[model samples]
Target: MKAAITLESVTIRTELRPGDIGYVIYMHGDIYSKEYGYSLGFESYVAESFVEFYKQYDANLDRVWVCEHNEKIIGFLLLMHRGKAAQLRYFIMEKPYRGIGLGKKLMNLYMNELNSLGYESSYLLTVDELPAAASLYKRHGFRLTEEKPFSDFGKPLMEQKYELMLR
Candidate 1:
């Protein structure tokens, strides 16, 4: 993981079709394991075939973005578009590139895109233990919408939901 903030060698863009689903699934799985201590049970792709996952992701490709570094997929963010409101379902950065601002860049891009799409607000959920993540969301104009105890991977965790009104 490169900890530098340079994205010169990295390319970030929207996922347009099913062809990019495999990379999204693989990167997302690895990132989730590193950040959340468990995979999203995304066992199909990069293990078996990605027929089912591909279909699902493809159906909502407009809400997904892929970041590639050195021609390999590194990270991704998934957004659930709901008319005027958007929910950030997942955001992850793999272990090797933890300290870099890739997470922030992904988030800024997501918010900017959503705003341009006429969204009035966006929401994201994060665990309270991840102070860095929570701070990042706050720095980007997200406020604490709610906080609650939630179980992740069978472990007790305090989850926080944040909202950013785009106006």
Candidate 2:
């Protein structure tokens, strides 16, 4: 099922404003998955403390873009670009906002932006534990580039990587 959805036009910025105070918490709460840590060759169940998350965000806020609806943040996209390669460091939607195709909308916008900015390709890594997310990536012309076992949450988990060559 789908509903007509509207997203607030976001202002992309390289500067972190005062409103970014709790950004670390919001970003990491969804990104840190014991399941994902294991799949990426990290310790099983690796969880970052508030301080650690904040430090990371402080160092990388310039690569992040936030999505706000009606004055509330509902999602964000963290990007990393190097030469011709772009990585989706983080992408997520809060529970109340999931499954209305916002993800696809956000990705399409990002892809167009990246293309205009001269990126030739994009890639992302996710765990098999998140089949729905993997499927979303697949639906968008991403092809699996790798699958392997990794330790997350102190247990072995399967990690999947996907890539898309852009125009």
TM-score of each: 0.73, 0.67
Sliding window of 10 residues with minimal summed lDDT for model 1 = 41-50
Question: Candidate 1, residues 34-141: lDDT per residue as tens digits?
Answer: 766754544332334334333544333236667777766677676666556877855666665556668878878877777667778889777777788788888889
Please give the lDDT score for candidate 1. 0.67
lDDT of 2 by residue, 34-97 (tens): 3244232232222243233346443322255667765666676665664577777557666556
Q: What are the lDDT figures for the candidates, one per model? A: 0.67, 0.61
- Model 2 is weakest, by summed lDDT over 10 consecutive residues, at 38-47
Q: Which TM-score value belongs to model 1?
A: 0.73
